[model samples]
Target: MTAKEGVATGSVPSATPTEVADLARVEDRISFLYFERCSVSQADNSITVTDDRGTIRIPAATLSVLLLGPGTKISHKAMVAIGENGSTVVWVGERGVRMYAAGRPLTHSSSLLQRQAALVSNRRSRLAVARAMYQMRFPGEDTGGLTMQQLRGREGARIRNVYRRLSKETGVAWDRRAYDPDAYEDGTEINKALSAAHTCLYGVVHAVIVALGCSPGLGFVHTGHERSFVYDIADLYKAELSIPVAFRTVAEEPVDIGSAVRHAMRNVLYDFSLMDRAVRDIKALLNDDGMADLGGPEENHVGLWDEKVGEVAAGRQYGPDDGE
Candidate 1:
């Protein structure tokens, strides 16, 4: 790509591999953002999100995910800035149901992802990882002798049990896992609650997946879909996070149930410290070395984590030069 094309497309300028690799593990940004009923415009080397309330200047580089909900418009330049920052831009429906996602491809370096690909490529290794995932999901539940079919059946039973328990708690009927992404207007309260909760979880997982340089499509439990690995990791925490949040939100039965669920999901996600837990859990789920593998090769990361380096970078205010 030409330099001009690179600039227009938000390509890295004079960026070294070590720098890119260092950025891959950062967790300082807000985990999620949403834009609707406004225009996202490129202004003065930053993206300005304008709505009825006023204008909010976004340092896109410092955000994990930007959700473009309904009634949103964005400029080409704004898109470029977002991609350059390596932040994900997702077009979503009511309560964060993903419609489309923008932003850059996997850019980080991690030995864990290399190991993950190797395991996924082999039949025995892949199944072992799947079993590991199952074990991680249900702690203290021995599944060493169970086949894949049995594991799936157990997962189904566990989900049904969660629903039944929550149904009793909140009086919201969960006939089955049901929600139409295309028909958001008709989704039942329980279904909407499930979608809201999962959408938040998905955003956090996606950020970590991209940050760790792992392919979201690579999966053991959930196969297929662009967010297969996203689903697999999210399922680990779904029962504990989403189910109760959904039930409680539905029990309120507010006039604007969708909005209420969305608000509640975000609150619980932050209050419960889901982002940090997600990063830690994903590493353990995928590799024995866990968080250690996330930093990549030791030689490549001499002073990346030094406090002085962090203080300098942190002191530099966010602006047009953030990606630089």
Candidate 2:
């Protein structure tokens, strides 16, 4: 099914003979599946699929992307069948009926790993950029004058304020105590918190892509992690978009505790447009890299992570310490 310009929604016609044959042919391609706006019914070991048009019986193994669109219902047994297939079934509408496929090829494990590596690399790159920007924004500050602990404290406050604003705008709640600058006194705690924050943001991006039936691992900005390019793409927004918005929100309206800060953040998440802009910016970056044709059924280039690692290893391989 395809949606033309300005169409609010589109419908999938009943599967033709060729489409049915294609489904059968690709049955064994992956162990996971996703479904949208469809239903599956089970009788013993076999399953029957019902749509607005009619019903068809097929072996349980032949099913993937089992969609149950709005107003559609499925028995607990059917839900179990769907889960047992290792499929990620999405509820697209109210009635538990509309759904679509969010599955990936089972053989794409290596791709998934490469995608993850790419994501990490992309994250580091963006973080480096943000850090550079921060340094430029405050160039006169003397690093030699302040202890490392003090610098981390300042960064923690900045990050916390940003999180508070993000929580207010996005309506996503996070622990406010998680942002305590003093907690980072030893420096280790702040680093761990940042890492955790990155992982959480990555998960949200992956979920969004799964909903769109896109491959998260096949990314435009964060290329190379096998099953998580979406995460990489999301990282680009963490500092520039999410952080600044979150901080601005917090500074404008003060919150006492971490939970309250998170509560404020939930409001920010309700605006999908902000998230959409972040995705668009990522796409723009990918276009600049001359890799706009990602996520297609073709091999991708070597990831940035691999290149950096290679550079570091080569330097060590030929370093003066090698003879020691």
Candidate 3:
């Protein structure tokens, strides 16, 4: 039997929504989800889904994940409803369905604590590297190269500058750093944590772009014809979303690096809820009128937003007024 079929008939008990309101409210939050093995059925004007936890019944909207047996069939009406709702529909084994609410709304507030921690940690690491680089590049100045304390100061300033820019652009004031690393950890340890966190953050960004409908290969900040700009956008969120969580996960779990670490990082891509925020934020940014026109018929039409449209227009091989 297929995995879907095995899940449907498996001895595992289904998971039920703890509260009906929880299910109803879920539509507004996470529009996408992963269900390992589950069953969905329609009865008495209500659709019920059974999983290892329990059974949940409510009005059917759009089901993105649907798994049915080889001979199973689905009605066109169901398919239409699913499509109309912008839900992703997946069919697997017999009598199994996984439904994810499409366009799931996300709030920065919900993840503020974790995001703030990540930002602070990342900023610290970046500043540390920058200070080291600066000292190496310019030795024996009046300052005798920046010390760890000086690095912290520079880190704070740079983070604040970036934070202010992001706030002005996005209208969100992120939390500032609260804890001092000198009181808690050494510089080398902090740097190591930061690197691991950054790698995980990159992974999350890639996942988010894939979830959102942007090709990762097209990029904005990291210039290269072959590079994925969407990946760059995702990278922007690493400091605010993924890094802190990865650090905490690694610190708390303390697992040795191996296949397990790789696997754990993959799971953390979804666990930290970075993908959800990535999709939501990217969609907003992409849909904005100020956003540069990235996808079009031009050969080098990279969608890098510039405040001065005339500058980009001048750089363009073909202007909007130019006739093809």
Best by TM-score: 1
Residue 315's C-alpha lDDT in candidate 1? 36
lDDT of 3 by residue, 203-298 (tens): 345434432334445443333543244345644554444444434444444543222233454466456555455555554434333432222123
Ordered from best to worst lDDT, the candidate numbers read 1, 2, 3
For model 2 the TM-score comes to 0.31
Stretches of candidate 3 off by over 4 Å are 1-28, 40-49, 57-82, 88-217, 221-230, 254-287, 290-324
**Residues 154-272 of candidate 1: C-alpha lDDT, one tens digit per residue:** 99899889999989887877788777888866888778777877776687678767765678888877787888888888888888888888889988888876677667877887787
With a 3 Å backbone cut-off (N, CA, C), the pairs that clash in candidate 1 are none
Give Cα distance to truth, residue 149, candidate 3, Å. Answer: 28
True-structure lDDT of candidate 3 = 0.38
C-alpha root-mean-square deviation, each candidate: 10.2, 15.3, 17.0
| Number of the top-ranking candidate, with lDDT as the measure | 1
Residue 23's lDDT within candidate 3 is: 24
Overall lDDT per candidate, in order of appearance: 0.71, 0.41, 0.38
Off by over 4 Å in 1: 1-26, 43-46, 105-107, 288-324
TM-score of candidate 3 against the unseen true structure:
0.31
Candidate 2, 1-324: lDDT as tens digits: 121122112452221111121222222322122233457665543456777778776544354334333555666555544443333444443212112334433221234333333543575544443343234324576444444356556656766687666666755455644433344333322232343333333434444344223466564333466544555456545665445444444444443222222333334433434335544443343322433222333422333234445522222345467662
